[model samples]
Every structure is written in C-alpha cells, then in structure tokens.
Target: MWYLNDDLVDSSYHAENENQVINHISVPNIQRSQHRANLECRARNTVLISPVSKTVSIELNLRPLSVSILQRHSQLSTHTQYEITCESWGSHPPPTLLWFLEGQELKGVTTEESRSSNTSVSRLLFTPTPEFDGKRLICRASNPLLPGTAIEDFWQLRVVYSPILSLRLGSSINPNAIKFQDDVYYECVIRANPPAVKLTWYHNGENLKHTPTSGIIMSNQSLALQKVTRASAGIYVCSATNNEGEGRSNPVELKVMYAPTCRNDLSSAEGTPVIIAASRSEDVNITCEMDALPESLRFHWAHTNTVGEAVDLEPEIYTSQGSKSFLFYNLRSEEDFGTLLCWAQNSIGTAERPCIYQIVPAVDISNYKQYPNYGIKHSFSSSPQFPRHG
Candidate 1:
C-alpha cells in the first residue's frame, strides 16, 4: 500500500520479478501547500504483525504565484527622493528580487524574505532627473531553482521640471547684414516637462506688448518686426512660464543700418526757411548736424537764387567732422545772398529733405529814432528786395 499524507493511492503499481515488491504512486497537482508532506509505503505478509513501513518527507520546488508593486504616485518631481516596494509570494525558497531601469539591472537595492510565509520583498530608493522621464522602471522577481522564470512590474516614469528657453534670430536673417526698413523676426525655442502656458518678450529690459498696428506682431513663440528702423536696434530676450517654473533666455543684440538724418533740434518744418541777417563783405559760418548709424556723413552745399539759378559751393569752403559739417561764406556781392541748401548722405542713402537757409541783408539801425523811456519805431518808404543772380 502507498499513502501520500494519509490519502490512499488507488493506482499503485507493482514491479514483477523483484526481490522486494516495488510499488509506485504518483502525486498529482503538486502545490506549495504540499511541501514537507509525508509519503509512506507499507508491506504486510499475513496481516498480523506490525507492517514494515518506509516513510519519506516530500519537498516541492514552486515558482512564485504573484508579483506586484505597491501602489504609489505615478508622477514624480526631479531631484526628489522616493521609496518603491515590490512583493512576491508562494515561492519555495523565496524569490530573488531586483530593480531595473530601461532593461539594465540596478545595484544597491534592499531586499527582505520570510521562509515561514514564502514571501520576498524588495525596496528601491529612487531619485529621478529630467532625462529619466518616459523611461521604464521595473521590479522583477525570479526563483534561482526555477530557471527561465521571471515576473516583473514596470511603469513609465514621468518627471516634472522647469522650462528651458533659447532666443534666436529668424533663420533667413543675417545678424551682421540687417538694415533699416527691412523685415525681420525672432524665435523663442523652449523645452519643458509640462507645456509652457505663457511667453513674454523683452527689449532693453522693458517688457514688450503685442501691438500689430505698430509693426510689432507677436505670437506664442515668435515676434515679427515689419519695416524695422534704427529705434528697433537693442537687446532682446525671451521668457517662458509653466507649472513647474519660469525660464529666461540669453539676450540677443540687433543692429540696424540706416542713412543720415537731420538732428531733431536742427530740423525744420517742411517748406519753413531759416532766416539769416548779415551785412555785405562779412563772413558767415553755417553749421549742419545729422544723426546716422555709421556716423560717416558726406555733406553737399548749394546756393539757389530767387531767379532760379543754382550753383554748387566749392568743397574748400566747407569742413566736415564725423556727422557734422560747417560752411564759411563771404557775402562779397549781392549774388552770394540766396537760399543755402545743406544735403547729407551716408552708406544707406541720402537724407530725404535738405536743411534750407535764407540769406538776407541786415536792417539799418541809423534810420530809426529813439525816444526817452520809449521803444524806437522805423518807417521806411521802400521794402527790402531779394537778390537775383544770373
């Protein structure tokens, strides 16, 4: 008779022609609960004396029934420390536990096991960086006795971080070749864990607003400047904001090329003439100042009379320094009295309007009468005449 843990084996078979009758019994559906069970075989010739019995203890090797990771937050912040635990049950000698990241084994992990309960546990201390986001983190369990049997619990990592920003000129623009009245733009490149919600632009430390009508068109990631002028030349920066934090880019400088223009204080209204009174045979000095990017200005002086006759002034009569020019004229005769036009030119182009000056004869003070404690009033029979040249 064969018995496995007090259960009768009805299908016991006997081998023929053996010195001692050999009985074979099969234990079906072995499980972890059957480990250390007793198996017994007994032989009785006359059913009277105590049966000779042979007993053996069964030790079963089983794979883990379940392996899982404890519930925890899926989202993690960069540079923060966290603890993750994994558990396995129903292995005979307790399964070997380990941690893995992106298919590579992780060292320095802590593990605990209980032989009485057939359970194994592993704990991993983790710290994540921005580069670790979207990678797989795994907790694997396997038994050394059972080859090629491994179970794992894995999840993709989500790491939160602040925004990173970079500011650049448009792809089609050349930093060294920008010019006035040219169309240009800037681009803001960003990288962030969470998408950026707001983007801001700055010029020379002042915040810039979106005003399309003024040639400043702004979008989420770019700024377009139409017909750029000298005033548009300055330092520019871009910034991005998200839930994590804000990030700012390095400053980019813009240089614009432009022609010379009259200085604001020296400029005159259109068609308004500046009058100069001087006597004949006297030398008068006229100065013209201009504003330009390159500051290398070329000046041209011309005289146009009331009779429509025009003559270019000799270069020897004028001196130029930087963006300013001075002309000396001697009114030796009436022909020298006329309209003086000062024209300035630079690398870009010439000024749109020339500075105009009218040369007129000075008033005679001897003909006016002065009274005590009263202002003088002069009465002349003839009006002043404008000079004519042929």
Candidate 2:
C-alpha cells in the first residue's frame, strides 16, 4: 500500500528478484498552498504487524502567478515627484522585481519579499518630465530559478504638460516677396495633453482681435489677412492655452514690398495739391519726398497750365538723392504759374499719384509804413525781375 498525505496510491508493481514493491502517484494542478506536503510509502500484509513506512516532503520551484502595480496614480505632473508600488504573488524564494519605462530599465527601485505569503513587492520613486508623457511604465517579476519566465504589468502614463505651439505662414505664399494688397494668412500648430482650450494671436506685441471688416479674420488655429499693406509688415506671434499652462511661439516677421508713395506726414491739405505764393521772375526751390521699399528712387518733374497743356521738365534742373528730390525752378512768367507735379519710380513700379504744387502770384507787399529808426522800410519795384539760370 502507498499513501500520500493520508491518500492511498492505486497503482503498484512488484520488482523482479527484489523484496520490494514500486508505487507511482500522480498529482494534478498543484497549488502554492500544497508546497512542502508530506508523501509516505508503507508495506503491510493483511493488516498484521506494524507497517514499515518511508516519508518525504515535497519541494517545488514555481514562477510567479501574476504581477501588478499597486497604489497607482491617475495623473502625473511635470517637475513633480511621485512614488509607485508593484507586487507579485506565488513565487518560490520570492521573485525578483524591476521597473521600466518605455522599454528602458528604471534604477533606484527598492524590492522586498515575504516568505510566509510568497509575495514580492517593489517600490519606484519617479519624477515626470514633459517629454515623458504618454510613455509606458512597466512592473516585471521573474523567478531566479525559472529562466525565460517573467510576468509583467504596464500602465500608459498620463502626464500633464503645458501646450506647445508653432506659428507658420500659409502655404503658397512667398514670405520674402510679399507685396501690398496681397492676401496672406498664418497657421498655428499645437501639441498638448488635455488639448488646447483657447488660442490667441499677436502683432507687434499687441493682442489682435477678429475684425473681418478691417480685413483681419481669425479662427481658433488660423488667421487670414486680406489685402495686406505696408502697415501689415511686423512681428506676429501665436499662443495656445491648456489646463496645464499657456505657451507662446517665436515671432515671425512679415515684410511687405511696394512702389513709391507720397509721405502723408510731409504733405499739407492731405492729398490735395499744396499752394505756393511766389513773385514773377523769382527763383524757388521745391522739394518732393516719397516713401517706398528698396529706397532707391528716380524722380520726374512736370508743369501743367490751367488750360491742361503739359510738358515734362528737364532733368538738369532737378537733383535726386535717395527718396527725396530737389527741383530749382525760375517762375519767369504767367506761363509758369499753373501746377507743378513730381512723380517717383522704383523697382516695384511708378507712384500711383504724384505730389502736386499749385503756383500762384504772391500777394503784393511792395509798400510798408515806416516809423523812426525802430522799423526799417521795405519796398519792391513795380516790375520785379530776377535773373534766370539754366
């Protein structure tokens, strides 16, 4: 008869030319609770005399049944520290535990074992960075006696990070060659966790608003600039906001090119022609200034009578320097008393409108009252004539 843990073994065979019987016992689905169980073999004839028995204890080397992370956190923040624990059960001599992030081994992990409970626990101290978002964190348990048998549990990290933004020019537009009245646009690309909730645009350090009537249209991630002018050339920026924080992009400068135009600041009566009073046969120096890109400018002067007759003035009477032109004119007769126009040209094109000056006869100041020596008498000849120079 054979018994294991007080259970009889059903199969036995006699050894040839030996005074002994060999018994075979099969146990299925052994559990960790059954480790070190006693197994006994005994010999008896008809229940007579005491049975001769041999006993032994069962020993087993087992791989861990499962591995899991304990004290798990739902969220992790950048620049903050957090501690996590992992535990494994049902491994003989306690399983070796380790931590990993995105397939890379993690250091400074502390591991402890419980012989009574057949459990292994490991603790990991971690500090998350913005770049660590969405990475995989793993807890692995392996038995030293069992090679190639490792169990693991993993978590997808949900790290909270500030928004990332980039502002770019719209496709199909050349940044270096933007011209006046050209339609332009910009795009804002964003990368963030928890997604972006708001977006803003800026120009020249001032926040911009959506003003469609003024040709500035804006959306959550884009801006459309209709009919851009020289005023539109400036530094532009984009920003995005999320639950974590706000982030701003680097500045992008827009340069607009255009032809010559009259400088409004230097003009009197705005765009209307300026009136100059001068005497006949008097020499006058008229100056014309313009604003344009590429600075270099070519100027032309012309004269027109009230009857609409016009003639281009000779270039020898005018000298141009950069964006300004100086014209020396001799108003010798009534024919020179009409309108004088100045036009400028650059690489872009000719000026859309010329700077105009209306030449009229000066008010007569030929006679003045004289008092003692305190005031000096001033007078002009009835027929004033000044020498003319080519």
Candidate 3:
C-alpha cells in the first residue's frame, strides 16, 4: 500500500499465499478550469486473502474531464422548446452530471446519459424565457470511480433572439424624375430584443436628424420621415445593433416628386385652331393646356374604338400633353367613329380627356345646294364642318 501527497491519491495491492493475486491500479489526471474545486483518488483491496487486507489513497494534481455543450435552439422564447447536449470524457468512472443557472444548481430534473466505459454524457431540455436574460447557465460532469475519489468538468451557455425590421412609405413617387414642393415621409419599424435593441435611420447614406431615439413605442425598432425633399430621395438604411451583433434592413430607394406652387407657361384654350398633320401611319398631334413644373409640355393622342381599346386612324397619331399638332397617315375603316384620347401624366397625377371623331365616305356636293342662289360649281373641294352632337 502507498499514499501520495498527504492522501490526495492512494493505491494498494494485497496478495495471499503468493498465488499470483491480481492487484494493480492507476489514478487518472484531474484538472479544473474556472469551475471545479477539488480532485481525489483512492484504491482499496476488495478481497481478504486468508489473513490480511489493505487500502491506499492519494492526492493527485490531475486534470478533470473536459465538458462542452452544444445548443440546438435557433430562437428562444418563454414557451419555446429546446435541446441541450452535454458531453464529458476522461479516464475516470461513474461521473456526475449537473446543471446550473447563475451558479445555482437546478433540482429535481431527470437526466439521461451514456458512458464511454469511463466517460459521461447527459442531455437536458427547458423552455427559454425573458427571465433567463443576463443569467449564466452551466453544465458539469463529474466522475466518482473509487471511494472518496471524484473529478468534474463544466461548460457555459448563452441564449439569443431574432429581430424584425421594415420600412414604411407615405406616397408613391416617380423614380425617373421629381418636380418640386412634394411631401414625402419614410418610416422604419422593428421588434426589439429582450434586452432592447438600438435602431438608427439613414437617408442617402447620411444619418437623419434627431435619430437614434432611445424608445419610440413598444416596438424597439421603428423610424419615420416627413415632407420628403430632393435630399430625401436616396437609398435609406436602418440598422439594429446589440451585444449579440447587428441586423440591417433591406435598403429602400426613395423618390421625391417636385410640385411647384406656380404653374407652367402653357395653355390649350377654346378657338385655338391647331393643324395636325400625319407624321406617321400611327401619329396624332395632341394640344392641351398643361401646368407642368417642367415649364413647357407636349401632348400625345391616340384613337380607340367603342371597345375602349385603341384603333388605327388614316395616320397614326400619338401625342403627349403640351403638344398642339399630330399626324396620322394610316386610317383603317375598322377604326371609324372611334374616340380619341389625350392624356398627360406628371408627379401629381394623369390629366386625360377624350374626343370622338367619325369617318364617312365622300358625298356629292349637290347635296348642299338648297340655299345657294348665285351660280357655283358643284365640287367636293369645299364642305361644311359637321355639327357637334349634344
């Protein structure tokens, strides 16, 4: 029998009658890392050989089994089910498994485990809640192979949550161009973390004034902009940062329209005889008074049948707002008596009106000779304009 380091570790071998009795044993290494406190090793003779029995113990500075944890929970919640796997392996026997929160042991929880002929493994489960925030959780694995001999290892665990972020727009603005004097607003919203999340708003790569409000509403993440201007027309970004890391929202491009208080210098009034010649087979000159911020405006015209669909004229005429003349060279009979529509769209809205035109076959000039007293040639060169229908 022998004792090492004031009984920190011990060993013993007893033989009777020198009959080659078996009696050899070894003490494994035990180490502690920021958790465990002590390690002990001991050996004793289990059998009394005819006359004598002996035992020994030793105090060895061996390293304990290393313990680690693998978490399978992606999102944490008060009622969210999750799994935790704890594993510890060392050259020790009959290890102990323990769970802790804030350095306090959890009680009365059933534990399942497997041993590597000398190691220990355990799995535990629990629902995460807000109360778990800022608290340290740990798992310990210990081995007690011999009487009064034990070793242990431990691991730390952490929990995290997911966040939500979104953008809000007041009105739709044209991406191509903006006029002036238009009001635009941008809003950002998000669901804050348990400990809370810091949110920031940026416009056109620059931070918004008075941004980073500590808390706006119950939601930890939300932002808004008012009366958008040309400066507001740019990529907007929202970022949420916390101890866990950072989450950013999808970039949103803002377009601010220009709506000047004054009107453009263009007009289409009654008694204005604008001649429209066919520029192409499907061309039409459109004339209208437009108060466009771009100063002057052009109009486009199109002919549509009774079906409210477009039809062909002798010359196709496509006119936009502010244009006074259009040409149509290809006139299809199927498009006769169809309506012509003129529309102008700007940052505000679309200005559109329709006019009807009828196509008729040529008639003899003698049909209008009822009131002619002086001698005149009967020809189709001159014809009276058709009267408007009520």
What is the alpha-carbon lDDT of model 2 when measured against the actual structure?
A: 0.81
What TM-score would candidate 2 get against the native? 0.56
Compose the digit string of candidate 1's lDDT tens values, residues 154-237: 878888877788899999999877889999899999988898888999999999999988899998799999899988999999
Candidate 3, residues 1-390, lDDT tens digits: the string is 333433433344566665544445564553332122332334344555443445333333333357776663444654466666666665233357777876788654455445434345667677765556557667766544434433333443345654445766534644445434444444566554544357777766776556324221223344444444545567877776665456667788866554321111223332222222121123232334444444344344566654567743332344332423344324334443244544345555444332222222223223334423312221122334332221
Find the candidate with the highest TM-score and give its number. 2
- Ranking under lDDT, best-scoring first? 2, 1, 3
What are the lDDT scores of the predictions, listed in order? 0.79, 0.81, 0.46
Q: What is the lDDT of residue 173 in candidate 1?
A: 96
How many clashing pairs per prediction, in order? 0, 0, 60
Compute each candidate's TM-score over C-alphas. Answer: 0.53, 0.56, 0.30
Residue pairs in collision within model 2: none
Candidate achieving the largest lDDT: 2
Residue runs of model 1 more than 4 Å from their true location after superposition: 1-159, 204-206, 264-271, 306-308, 364-390
Which residue segments of model 3 deviate by more than 4 Å? Answer: 1-119, 122-157, 160-164, 168-187, 190-198, 211-222, 229-231, 243-245, 255-343, 350-390
**lDDT at position 248, candidate 1:** 96
